[model samples]
Target: MQALKHFRIDFVITAAVLVVAFLYDSWAGVGLTAILIVVEIVFSFDNAAVNAKYLDRLNHFWQTMFLTVGVIVAVFGMRLVFPFVIVCLSGSISPWSALNLALEKGDPHTPGTYGYILTEAHPAIAAFGGMFLLLLFLDFMFDEDREISWLTWIEKPLKKLGKLDVLSVIIAGIFLLVASETLVHETHVHTAVQMRSIVLFSGLLGIILYLAVSGLSTMMEEREAAKDHEFEEADAHSSTGQKVLLAGKAAFSMFIFLEVLDATFSFDGVIGAFAITPDPIIIMLGLGVGAMYVRSMTIFLVRNGTLAEYRFLENGAHWAIGALAVMLVISIRYDLGEFVIGGVGIAFILAAWASSILANKRDAVAEGATDSTEQGANV
Candidate 1:
């Protein structure tokens, strides 16, 4: 009951959204909307888990901003408006015409269908999103302070190599080059020397965007942490004020990362939604509803301290990100069933959870043994 109290508003709003969705369309429309919601939630579970780590660091104001302002970007900016923008860019159509294409319900049979436009445009999307996600994975995996390792043999060495700030960029660039050259869709007819130029350039753009935001934010945060404050109790309040300012800066930076991260996660769900139906309104309703739930779930994780308890859950989510990154690049040239994409993530999640339980049990046994040995020595 206590737990449910905190989420009463989320529950009410979610229920209201579903009710409105049902009322907005025919039975088939309602059914499609529900499916879209479920699909988004499943695909977005890792995204929620990853988001909670950053959101937890923020103060209340930033947290509120994430829920209110950030949700709009997730729901409308990415889920609704972004795809049309992608079509316009990829298909060279006007914004209005691109929107109409999205609304027309894509025809799989026609070679020049909206579905075809979106599908054809995927290489660029994959290049951009893949690099962003790969960098995200590398950053986490290479953290020197990270103690637990899901894949120690590989992760341990990566952590050591993290001494160089640019290693992740180097590795990611290599990946971009190899994937660009080898995995390109056969339809592209660029001169042999320039085959992967566009894709590679798009990936470079992803890296620059990531570094621009993440680097600036990190610099501000480190500067704040290095400031000297009076150790006397008389100055404690002033020191606390400075800490708040630092937190605010960091939170602002995190807000940017969170929005970009959410946008990357949406690429799969948005593209996949077209597979089910091309009705833009349905895509909006379904993905928007799911985004709401993910927000609620993120809050729930923070309030409950779920990540602190799970131990290896964040690691699993990072691994999932890595897997998804590779899969996106592969999906550019080949067809990957939606089930396969979703299933790979789900498997990692389950494995991490079970491992957490075992780790807890081992710690319990070790503690019990220590206590028993001390008692015997005292006796």
Candidate 2:
């Protein structure tokens, strides 16, 4: 009952969206919308786990902003408006034309259709999102401060390599160069040179954006830590309002980082949603509901201290993110169906959960043995 309360808002929102979907197109609309909601949730389950790590740092106020303002950005902003922007930019058409194209609901098979235009833009989208996610995985793998190692062999060496400055950047740059040259050949939409240029430039932008957000977030966190240290050293009791203000300021960069991270995660889902149905309205309704549930899950995990309880859960999520990054890049050349993409992440998460349970049992048995041995010695 307590756990169910966390999802009360999600339940209400999902019911309302489903009703709207049903009214819009009868049974067919409801069916497609249901599929989309499932699709979005499956594809982004790992995302919820990753989100909880950062969302937990935020105070109640900013967390509310994540649900409210963030939902608008996730739903309409990414699902509806972002696609229009992509169509306009990729098709070299005006916003009004793009709007018309979307409303027309033309066949995806036909060129110049909105779906076709978005599909045409997939390479650039994949490249940009892939690079950003790749860097995220690289940074996590290489972090020396990470005390827990899910895959000891891989993580330990990576942590040592992290001591080298800009190592993640160097590796990511090489990946972009190789992917741009090789993957661009797979698509003949533009000449090889043109396609390569698009992939390279877009991938570079992803890397730059990641660097900027991460650097700013680090700076803010360090500054906040320094202030806290001074307060502690001086034994000063800060006012509640002042502490709240400081927390909000410190969390601002994290908020921005989470938004960008969400955007990258959405790129694949938005594009893949077309494969299910090309109606932007239905897409928004379904994916929007799924996004809300993900937010609810994030907050639930934070409130329950799920990350601490299941120690390997976060590690599993990062592994899934790494796999997703590779898959996005590979998808530039081949269409690995949504099933494969979603399944890999799910598998990692389940495995991590199982491992955590086993570790707990082992500790319990060891502690029992020690206690029995001490009793025997006393006897």
lDDT top scorer: 2
Model 2, 239: alpha-carbon shift in Å?
A: 19
Task: Point out the worst 10-residue segment of candidate 1 by lDDT.
Answer: 225-234
RMSD per candidate (Å) reads: 3.0, 2.8
lDDT of 1 by residue, 1-379 (tens): 9668876876787677677767767677778888988888887888888999888877777878888888888999998788878778777889888867766776733555676777667777888898999999999988999988876778899899889989999999999989988887455334444536768888888888888878977876666555533332356576565434336566688788888988988888888887887677888888898898888788778768899898988888899899988998888678796778888987887788888889989999999999999999999
- Estimate candidate 2's RMSD in Å: 2.8
Candidate 2: list runs displaced more than 4 Å.
Answer: 186-189, 233-246, 377-379
- Tell me the whole-model lDDT of each prediction, alpha carbons only: 0.81, 0.88
Best by TM-score: 2
lDDT (tens digit, per residue) of candidate 2 on 74-131 = 9999889899999999999999999999988887768999999998899899999999
Itemize residue pairs with steric clashes in candidate 1.
Answer: none
lDDT of 2 at 208: 99
